[model samples]
Target: MKRWIILDRDGTIIKDKNYLHDPNGAELTEGAADGLRMLAGMGYSFVVLTNQSGIGRGYFTEDEMNAVHLRVDEMLACSGVRVSGWFHCPHRPDEGCSCRKPELGLVRRAQEELGFSDADVAFVMGDKKSDLEMAEALGAPSVLLMTGYGAEEYAKGARGTLNCGNLRDAAKAIAEFEDGAARASFSRDLREHAEVVSAMRSLEAQAGAAASVIISSLRGGGRLFVCGNGGSAADAQHIAAELSGRYLAEREPLDAAALSCNSSALTAIGNDYGFDKIFSRQLEAHGRAGDALLAISTSGNSANVLEAVRAAKKMGIRTIALTGGDGGALAREAGLCVCVPSSATPRIQEMHILFGHALCGIVEKTLCR
Candidate 1:
């Protein structure tokens, strides 16, 4: 489904220059470009709906208004952001045009042109009451930013709108909301699956098996190497940090490194040998016989992660894989494969972190004693 972010141009995206028509006068509000980029990453397309009354009042030409929009687009493009649509209501307040703020003409046009019918899923964002009114008319949620005339609007009792400090904050809030919704859906689905329950029952046994190898490796004075990609990359670093520092007890730091943490080495190896070789090369340099490699992958089939696992095996390092969905190839290759039952990425990741924390806690208790 195509979700739209309907934005008010002057105060929401750029500094409000009273009736801004000159391209040179257009300046992106701080973090505006980044905010739009964040929304773009979340699959929301932007449509700027602005009220350009200056053109209607004969204060500026329609051409001048277009030039300003061009400037805005150019600025946003520098950050790899693009505005999917540009709409304007160029009529005076007294003209009684239906396309003006608080009216649904522009939104209707957008719906007809863009081929989207669901208004409830769309978001309207601006710094004025009229924008909120428009959203209400369309049955869409609205976000009011405290940017240009926002303070005055708030003082005038602009209620029933989500208020934000800036566009960046609004973007982050929306992303979080989306993620929460996804997790909720995943949780509901997981409850109906008997396999997830079965998987939970096996966690203790799996953790014990993996913990035994990890504890023996550390006791033998060998280090731990961890690697993954995307969300798993973050999990890799997080687990490595917990092990190298203290997990739940105050104790001496253990030797652990997340191969995915070094951007310089990652880029150098990727550029020189290819993306699949990045983790493998890092493992070759840091991994040794008797050490342990903790490989995290939601699918358990990422080329880079698999390569690292193979490298660890070749180096005589014990390999542990945290994976999901039948555990892919890593389950067969690794010395210990702990597979989360759910196939959904978010659910798998949640289980991966939980498993990591448990293992870290067990290791901490053993080593500290």
Candidate 2:
């Protein structure tokens, strides 16, 4: 399923200014552009729903508002992001407009134009009570950021809502959550099929074994290699980065490298040998005995990742595969396969990160202790 996100503006997008409407003076809060760009890169289509009652009160002209939005788009584009749409409710409390906050009309308008019903969005992110209530009404998850009115919202016990320090943190959480849901949902039907479920269970057991191997290797002064393609490639690098350094925690850096981080090597190898050889070649060149290679593939069938794992095994490197669906062909060829029980690519990818983080946490605690 496609993942869409509804983001609030004013307090959420730009810094809240107590009903101020000078678009010329509007500026995005810290990390807002980065947050939006990160979500866009994760395949999320964004729609901005804001209560701009300042417009209804003649504080800012519609033309001025458009100019301000254009500025926001420009900033995002500079960071390689594009907003799908923007919706604002230009009515005051006195006017009692349905499109205003505490009402779902603005979101409804966005749903109509974007062709994604309320059910399609994974989460709504904002710093206000109306934002959470709107998300609840639509049955979508909500992330409350501690920016703008977020502190107040948090103080009011926004317990069920995912809480973050800022928009960037909130966006990251939503992205992770959506990916996990995809992985879980994909494996739902297979749970009823005894054979597949048994195989998956076996795979999970193997993952525990592999985790032990990884811990032992690191304790003995070993490193890790990770690789993939496109989004999976990003995941490969992300996981490696987290383990090598830390994920929201401070600690000594571990020895890890994501072969996918080298763009020059990828292109040169792809041009000379082939895309399938990019990872395997790197593995042959860099992998050593006792090192671990983590291979991530949504379909569990990326030729490059598979080839890389093969090379790692041949080179005496321990291997772990993070895959989705029926474990695909990679399941059979791995030392251990963490097959997230989800067919949905998004969800599987999400779980892969969590698994990576969890693995990192365990490794850090066990070794550094």
Candidate 3:
């Protein structure tokens, strides 16, 4: 996947010249080209999201803007840097346009054109509150450069963004942070394995019971429906796949499906009945008495997952909760609760998959026999 940095143009990458329409007047800001080049070397691409109210105010034409952009491009080329996209909003503030700074239009357009979005970006970088606001909307981190209006904005208490002072410092800080994260995650995972082991050990009977519940349903030819949200959704799919497809040996395919796997049904249900009904609505359609649901949730508090559990109970379907931190309300609600005894999310997730494998193994061994 292409990692991106959604950047600002004027007052960020170039010296702010107060709506100059002349290409000859354009200048690269201090450390702008070099900083961009550093990030490019690290396999990062750039998208320029800017607000050019000058165009709407009739201070510059689109053709003139293009010429100035071309000039900026030449300067960037000197540093061996290239931007993947240039997205700007040409609307006055009073126009109430969606594409302006602090709005998401420019960033959204860039995401569409570039085939990447917030999930693929490292961070947004700019010298103003608008840039930070855009990053906030995308749910991505942002770099606040103390260039252009950055110092002024900072002085006025624009917080919650990484203030790296300037383009050069920002690049170095990002590089260091990335490097540190990469180095730490390896050791962190290893150290956290003890938590997983302890959690798993503490829940041996619960794990076996969760498996036996599914085995009984499978023996009775009942389908299994799994549901979760976000990362838990992925875990739900993984568990479903292992059962319905295969785990470690050749066997007859089991009946299973992830409620969140069908995008059409999920989206339509979510849109029509609200997000809380997304999973429960599907359960209503496909789940029958004696069928099983393996509801996965790290915190066991996902509204949709809980709703699904309630729906399953009303249908006389059995519910097994795979969750962490005392299993939230799901622990109390489910027929069986395999609570991974850790509050840390990652540790809980690790134990969840382990529990899923154990369940899959037990079911396959019992049924295939």
Candidate 4:
């Protein structure tokens, strides 16, 4: 999970020399090296995404531009900081190529080249409006340094971006923001998990009761049918796998199946009947008297899962619904409903898997004995 910062070259990293091809003219902006060193220490790699349109205008050759970059790299290397990638667009403003700033070409090219296509980029920092626009396009925050064209661009009104006096200030601001966000996120996660633990404690008796029913049904030669949609669907498959294979101890495989696992039956039923009938149709095929249907739905109102529960009831199969949000309509229909107290979908899903694992463990113990 590497994080990176996209930087503009001419004005942001060094003095904007304006088509000057002399490597001798390359001069680092005040505090540029120090800022870069700080960011590097914070686990951020750097990518110079610049618009070197002077090549398109025939002001300088690409070879001359490389010389300038080599000089810049040498200066940064003195400070123990390295640019992981350097991407420049050699198109004039009138060229209409996708690689220019405010377009995603250079950024996309750098991401692909550096193996960071799916990585988290902290922000884009530069001294021009085009840089901010590029950051916005990439769904990242922008830092506008009042170094080169930044003051003029700021006067022209580049709103909704962090405005700093220099690269050093920008780096400090970003570091502080990231640190605060990390701490706040940690605190929020801790609170949310604590809430989950409390909810689980309240639901312990109901969970135990559900495990008892599942154990009895399986011992009496009844199969378990599990079904849901989306993340809940994944949870359904996981729970079924735990039961039909083994939870903790190796024993005879239990008769269990996740209704969402069969892709052919799902697509055929969904295409012929509709999405709502996908689970119910599968339940009809596999469900029988004395069997149990473990229906998981975060919203408790997933049409397909609800339909499956109805079908299970009609076929004399016992229904245990793991749901959230006042249990929705599925709670009313199910014989036993374990509803996590929170309406938040993610929290509910976490509790559902915990409950599933606990139930599987209990069933494995009871049946093995």
Which predicted model would earn the best TM-score?
Answer: 4
RMSD of each: 10.7, 14.1, 9.1, 7.1
Q: Write the residue-wise lDDT of candidate 3 on 124-192 in tens digits.
A: 999889899888988989998888898898899986457976777888888998998998998888888
Per residue, candidate 4 scores C-alpha lDDT tens digits across 286-343 of: 7788999999999888899999989989999999999987999898999999999988
Residue-wise C-alpha lDDT for candidate 2, range 1-369, written one tens digit per residue: 668888888777778877654556777888888888788878888889988777888887777778888877887787787788988888877998888866889888887888888779877888888899888988988888888888887898774368887778877787787788888976774554434444444445555666687787777788888888888888888878887877656778888788888889989999999999999998888778988988888899989988998888888998888898778889988888878776877667767776777677777777666
* Stretches of candidate 1 exceeding 4 Å from the true structure: 1-199
At residue 305, give the lDDT of candidate 1.
92
Clashes of each: 0, 7, 0, 0
Q: Stretches of candidate 3 above 4 Å error?
A: 1-36, 43-77, 81-181
Relative to the unseen true structure, what is the C-alpha lDDT of residue 315 in candidate 4, on a scale of 0 to 100?
95
TM-score order, best first, reads 4, 3, 1, 2
> Which of candidates 1 and 4 is the stronger one according to TM-score?
4
Off by over 4 Å in 4: 1-176
The models' CA-based lDDT, in order, is 0.87, 0.80, 0.87, 0.89
Candidate 1: the clashing residue pairs are none
TM-score of the candidate numbered 3? 0.58
lDDT winner, 2 or 4: 4
lDDT of 1 by residue, 1-369 (tens): 788889999889999989887899999987798889999988898888989889888999989999999999999999999997798999999999999989989888877777776553468999999999988888888998888888789889995357887889888888887788899988887774545656667678899988888898999999988889998899989999999977878889998888888889999999999999999998898778999999999998999999999999999999999999899999988988999978877678878888888889888888889
* Model 2 stretches with alpha carbons more than 4 Å out: 182-191, 195-369
Whole-model lDDT, model 2: 0.80
In model 2, the Cα lDDT at residue 257 comes to: 84
